[model samples]
Target: MSQHARLPLTLDQLWQFSLQYYSAREIKEACLHLQNHFHGNVNLLLMLKWLDEAKLTFAPQDWSKITQSLGNIESLLRDYRELRRKLKVHVSDSLYKETLHFELQLEKQQQTALVNCINSLTLTDCEHPHLVEQYCLQLGAERLVRIFIQPVSSQSHNL
Candidate 1:
């Protein structure tokens, strides 16, 4: 292996990959649905998509840590988003706007942390690209989303 050959993909590269993939009209809806309705980490989802594009696959056995940490990170972002939403209507208050802006930046930072963490993992085993695509099903993303729907719906209603 060459010195420049072994590093994992960076988050900025993943972000660019996502921007291009998510720009597709077909995927835009599904991606937004997973993101907005399910409160999924769209960036993570995009990372998986990018990995799939590269024909990379993850072992099902390696998923627990990833999902657990992602849940924790996503939970924090959810809280920040909810609090920011509550304060958004009071934009006349500079404090509220500034605080909301801070929260937005915090969410981005948290996501970057997640991307970095995933990149740091010693991901091994290679399967068909479908492995990553099938992961959401195996992970029960729909079921998880259902659990949080009432709160998410109420949040949406507020918007």
Candidate 2:
């Protein structure tokens, strides 16, 4: 009952964009580097990419919930990530690996829920499209790259 189709906009579309832009093997390495070193939120990174792809923006009210929910999920993700890392040393134990895998799946589900929650909100015109780029700049995070557009020798590029 809000605006927009959903959080991800297009799962396949956004994923394709993320793979092409945010998580290309090289870019993903950079992103994960940013994540491990900077505490950046990959889901938020992807969400911002999706927003840009959909040419959408969130209202302040919408962002309040979105940001709050992201905070909660990020905390859980951090905890699980730490647990998984600790468990990694014990990978010879199938239990530890299973636990890590479960944590990974739970993190994915949480991310999916976050996206669904975002999709449930209302969107306004992207007043300053650059906000997507600047969203986490002040937080000392999100330095994975400002642009995600594929280089097009044939067409002028933008993402």
Specify the highest-lDDT model's number. Answer: 2
Report the CA-based lDDT of candidate 2 relative to the real structure.
Answer: 0.59
lDDT tens readout by residue for model 1, 1-159: 112133466656665555566665656676666667655566666666555545455556656656665656677777777877787786678888788678656655655665666665665434445533464565456543332211212221111
Candidate 1: which stretches are off by over 4 Å?
1-6, 24-26, 92-104, 124-127, 139-159
Model 2 poorest ten-residue lDDT run: 149-158
Worst 10 residues of 1 by lDDT: 150-159
lDDT at 62 for candidate 2? 64
What overall lDDT goes with each candidate model?
0.56, 0.59
Per model, state how many residue pairs clash: 0, 2
- Candidate 2 structure quality by residue, lDDT tens digits, 1-159: 234544435444444554456434765775676678867667666666566655577665565576676766677778888877886776777888688678656656556765667667677556344444555573465554554332312222233
Question: What C-alpha lDDT does candidate 1 achieve relative to the native structure?
Answer: 0.56
Output the lDDT of residue 132, model 1.
Answer: 37
TM-score of each: 0.62, 0.67
Model 1, position 137, has a per-residue lDDT of 63
